[model samples]
Target: MRRSVLGLLALLASTALQAATSVRYCDYPVYPPVSWSDGKQPRGLAPTVVRELFGRLGYRVEMVVLGNWQRCLLDAAEGRVDVVLAYTSAQREQTLRFSKVPVLREEVAVFANRQHPLAFNRLEDLARYRGGLLFGESYGPAFDQFVAQHQNIEWVSSSGQNFGKLIRGRIDFVIQERRTGQLFVEHLPGAGDIVALPPALSVDYLRVAVSRRSPLSAHMAEIDAQLQQMADAGELERWLQESEVTYRDMVRQP
Candidate 1:
């Protein structure tokens, strides 16, 4: 009877360990000042915020870097991953459950080569020149509709490639978030030749989204409660500031 009781206790402990929730958080290769992968590892603002939020929630997180933004979204949508850090959109709401509070406000801006400087006071002004864009990114509803209607836009896989093309006079301008564009321009080889235009093209909120198929789906209320608490306590802003400083130091490294 003593031996049987000991064996039953061991079985219960094993089952408890197996039931612990583990989340696979997917991120794309590049976004910077927001989120990016260093080829082998993930880094940047979003990742930092996620680490704090989920770490405190007691969930085991495994960071996975998908090839691109589209892949990251796809993985999250299909429930292959537990979550994805992304910009919130009406379309995305159909696939993932977004956090109640946003992690950051993303401001998209136009970038042009210094030699062929360009500026636009309105969206219509952009129609005058050819532009380069990432393969599967949306600036916002208005800009996205504009890009779809226009035919001169070129698509590239990476910001580095877009900047390279812009420097070679292959494209008239490239659109990206203000801070991200600045970071790329400051670090890319022909740094001095690229510049971001004044005023922003669009501003959107970015948030953490949990996959519908994740086991954590049942705990959405609790997850959002923690996020709201962090926001209320100003912890989210502090994380963003810390991330900005860290990214600046990384870019300045030799």
Candidate 2:
């Protein structure tokens, strides 16, 4: 009876270990309406959807909020974190394995002060004016190349700061994700003075990426299957819309 009990205990332990897949997910501190950390807690749309995704996969997530976008990238690349919520880029693919299905498609746009408004039909049209962008954020390959060649574009830490610069006429325009910029405008003081301009810069799909060095790398196929299921069932879209409404309501509260 003692030997039988010990064997059963070992079996149970093995089953528990197989079921408990601990994921260390990291994201930047501020990218409102998408992903952000309120103090130590992860909040916003991406986190909401991510939590649901992993929950379905029978995995436990421990969020690690970094101080900046660069740090998040570095931590994921160095295997300090298991995964990161990030956009796929050619440069990043070297060290990170991206999800087969994207979580969301982000619409990138240009915003300028209402009083000092500027218009652009093409990428080259914006070359005459100064611009602001978040440090380490990428719009797309073309825009990234454009910003790299231009000296007039300045990088700030957050969208709020860029909007402030735009309102003050310190920068002629700022490029950011439309929904994210709108969220910042709704919350930040004096942000009402800034408006999104015509012509979107780019539309990039965002995905959850696991570090190449992570032990979870072998489970990429299973992760993609789960993501595909959510997409097919339309749960991903519903979660995104629900998260946006929830966040808006939270911000409006007294």
RMSD of each: 6.7, 5.8
TM-score of 2: 0.88
Please count the clashing residue pairs in each candidate, in the order shown. 0, 0
lDDT of 2 at 136: 76
Candidate 1 lDDT over residue span 170-231, tens digit each: 99999988988887677788668788888778888888898888766666666778788988
Superposed by TM-score, candidate 1 places the C-alpha of residue 222 at a distance from the truth, in angstroms, of: 1.9
Question: 1-254 in candidate 2: lDDT tens per residue?
Answer: 99999899867644553465777888775777787555558787777767777776667888887767788888889999988878888888989999989988888888888888676888888999999977778776887888778877988877667888888889999888888888778877777778887688888888989899987776676678888998999987887777677677777777
Sequence-dependent TM-score of model 1:
0.86
Candidate 2: Cα lDDT at 137: 81
Candidate 1 Cα RMSD (Å): 6.7
